[model samples]
Target: MTLTPTKLSKSEKTRQAILEAAQTLFYEKGYDGASVRQIAEAVPIDPAMIMRYFGSKEGLFSAAALVDLRLPDLGSIPRDLAGKGLVRHFLMLWEGDRSGIGLPILLRSAVSNQNVADKIHEVFEEQVVPAISGLVPEGEEDSCAGLIVSQLFGLALCRYILRLSPVAEMTEQEIVERIGAVIQFHLDAARDTAGSNRP
Candidate 1:
């Protein structure tokens, strides 16, 4: 007897099916409301398959949360114009995927879940903060980072997630310009402090 050629290996097929089902369920019902069995039912797979492949619901979520994280290189941003560069990049990042469910799930989970909180923190600590640190420096990095992060998250939550009028409807450039100065000030303060500390 000859073995028939298959499009995908059993494991690959299973994992793809699980990810598709989970993505749909997660978008429809949200991360918290979605359950392993619901995903299994959607994929018509055994519930144990979720754990077998992903280890846990949290692991599945982390896998699902993976995104391009599109950001311009911080070092390439001109030293004198880092603020404007950052603002442009930030707006593009959010606007490119306004309909994406990742940010909503992240924001909501950050409020109530430790694992999600860790994910949020890790994204900032590793990807975002490090980028900003290179732009600024070690001493005043946290001040500038925290300030910018707070404003960015607040804007994201209020405009994108909460759907606040007028504010949300503003053009991306308008929003960026409005917020850019504040972030610039924060960064400028960092630069000044770092300069002073250099002995």
Candidate 2:
């Protein structure tokens, strides 16, 4: 009997290296500051190979910044408390090592890069909308989703990015309680509006 370890193709290894370097550089230096050359230098590869693998700096960024919201399934949460559960999951993501990755990376770049901002918008449509669809009124998914995104991102911006006083100091429980209420209100508002039935 013989055992051999499977190996990643050279191309695959190169691609992974580029992404690792890209994420690190993008976090430290931001999209505008982290050049393709810098990423290539980190990988110790020819800069031309980067373009060959990813097509362009924008394409490379899109690949490296890909995010899965890893949204919690609301079905398991009580209907009324789904917002709290969702907010708690996001608070974990925002406050933990996940902060070093996609959400923060895209957010930091998005402030100055229109392309990154567009990428964030695309992420919202693809990930945020579907997660919120079951929680809000049928026709108001996008609207409610936008509200939730704005609420969560605003908190992240103030607390984590801007490092404002009270917000930054707020405990996770405080955030989950406060921000979760706002999210629940967004969901409740849509549901209530749908049932308002005023003509």
- The candidate maximizing lDDT is 2
With a 3 Å backbone cut-off (N, CA, C), the pairs that clash in candidate 2 are: none
After superposition, which runs of candidate 1 have C-alpha atoms over 4 Å from their true positions? 1-14, 24-30, 97-104, 195-199
Candidate 2 lDDT tens digits, 79-192: 899888988888777666633377878988899999899989998998889988888778889989998888988998899888999999989899889888999999999898
Superposed on all Cα atoms, the candidates' RMSDs to the truth, in angstroms, are 5.3, 4.0
Compose the digit string of candidate 1's lDDT tens values, residues 27-62.
Answer: 556668899999999999999989999999988987
Q: Could you tell me the C-alpha RMSD of candidate 2 in Å?
A: 4.0
Report how far off residue 68 is in candidate 2 (Å): 1.2
lDDT of 1 at 153: 82
Task: Report residue 189 deviation for candidate 1 (angstroms).
Answer: 1.7
